[model samples]
Target: MAKIVNREEMAQGTIILNEIIASRISRKAKPGQFVILQADETGERIPLTMADTNPEKGTITIIYMVIGKSTARFKDLKVGDEYFALIGPLGKPTHVENVGKVVCVGGGTGIAVLHPITRALKAAGNEVTTILGSRSYDLLIMEEQMKAASDNFHICTDDGSQGHHGFVTDVLKDVLEKEEIDLVVAIGPIPMMKFCSLITKEKNVKTLVSLNPIMVDGTGMCGCCRVTVGNDTKFACVDGPEFDAHKVDFDELGKRLASYLDDEKQSLEAYEKANKQ
Candidate 1:
């Protein structure tokens, strides 16, 4: 059983850190791999990226948000509680190289996803500049972690609470105007990633974005995680959770992602009502 060893409320706005004892998975997991875990025998399977790992301790840390019923179910589990099933180290790892100056941008939950990747890039001797953002100061996570992962760290908030008072792109644009950035990796809300792609494409800077489409089975057999990159279709669970930002068809991806909004809203509302005494 993959038991929860440590749990921390990373953010009040849905994010959490769940450290689970999965010896094999922890040992084999790479920077960009993810796992599909079920809350219980009857729980739905949900995929979460590995935020950190402790091979010696036989543990893997996953940061997630209580977005729908599957995640909200974690609220009932204690540290010692075990997940019903835990599968993978899925997806290809991030392509990290010492490509001169690297800029890693993350927003909201994406910060957690970007954490290990940034660390890897820094380890490869790239002069990493990390940009983390959130709508407000309170929602910003992994500030210290990001700082440790890059040579230079920046913060952006839609509201001027902790750092620059604007979107992350605002800071990114400023950086691009003066800096000789060699590579860029962006992970965040769809619109944010989309805009980041647009900017980098215009500047002719190579940019990559991590995709998180709806996934059922972690295998590519399901095809639910299909995404269009350039002219080819790729599966996010197997081929990537990352792709070239300039090549991805963001317009199609955005429309498909929004399809679940109504269902997600209803599920959250129903869950809230039931939990209310």
Candidate 2:
């Protein structure tokens, strides 16, 4: 059983958990890897990227937004609560090398996943710049952690509630115009990442994006998390949750993500009705 060491609300519907797991997984985890978790015996398994890991402490941190029935149940868990299954340290690690002047952009909950990658880039002798954004200041998560991971950081919100009064892409464009950046890494909602990739395309900067598709099995056998990259189908579970942003088909991915919306709504409604009774 994996015990939840701590749980805190980072935003209105987002929660971050520090959980204890087996030593083996912790030791193998690298930046950009993810894990499959089940809250209880009857719960469905869900894939979440590893936000941070402490090998010495044998603990892993995951930050998630509560958007579905399974995630809602996860949010109900408190400190000291035990998880039924925490199968982890999965997927390919980000290909980290000292690619000069790297810019890491994260939106909403993606900041958590971007944190470790930024740290890895810095350690690899690369100068790192980070941009974090959300709809409003109150919805932003992991600003401090991301700031600490990079040499330079910028924050953006849709409203002028904090930092720059525009999207992360706006800040990214400004920075790219001024600085000679070698590589760009972005993770967030599909639309946000898509736009970021578009902006970077104009500058011809190499951009990588982390994808979150509808995944069933964390392994390749399920075929549920397949995404097209450069006209080839790749499984997100095993092949990547990260791929070249310029080659990705965002329209197809967005359609695939919406395929389960109705089923998810029904499941949530049923779960709520049963609980109320």
Task: Choose the strongest candidate by TM-score.
Answer: 1
Q: Show the colliding residue pairs in model 2.
A: none
Q: How close is candidate 2 to the true structure, as a TM-score?
A: 0.96
- In model 2, the Cα lDDT at residue 172 comes to 95
- lDDT of residue 204 for candidate 1: 94
Summarize candidate 1's per-residue lDDT along 1-277 as a digit string, tens digits: 8999998886674688889999999899889888999988888888888889999999999888887777888766779999999999999999888999999999988888899999999999999999888988888888998999989889998889988999999989989999999999999888899999999988999999998898989899999999999999999999899999999998999999899878877887887789886
Flag regions of model 2 displaced more than 4 Å. Answer: none
Error of 1 at 42 (Å): 2.0
Candidate 1 total steric clashes: 0
Per-structure clash totals for the candidates: 0, 0
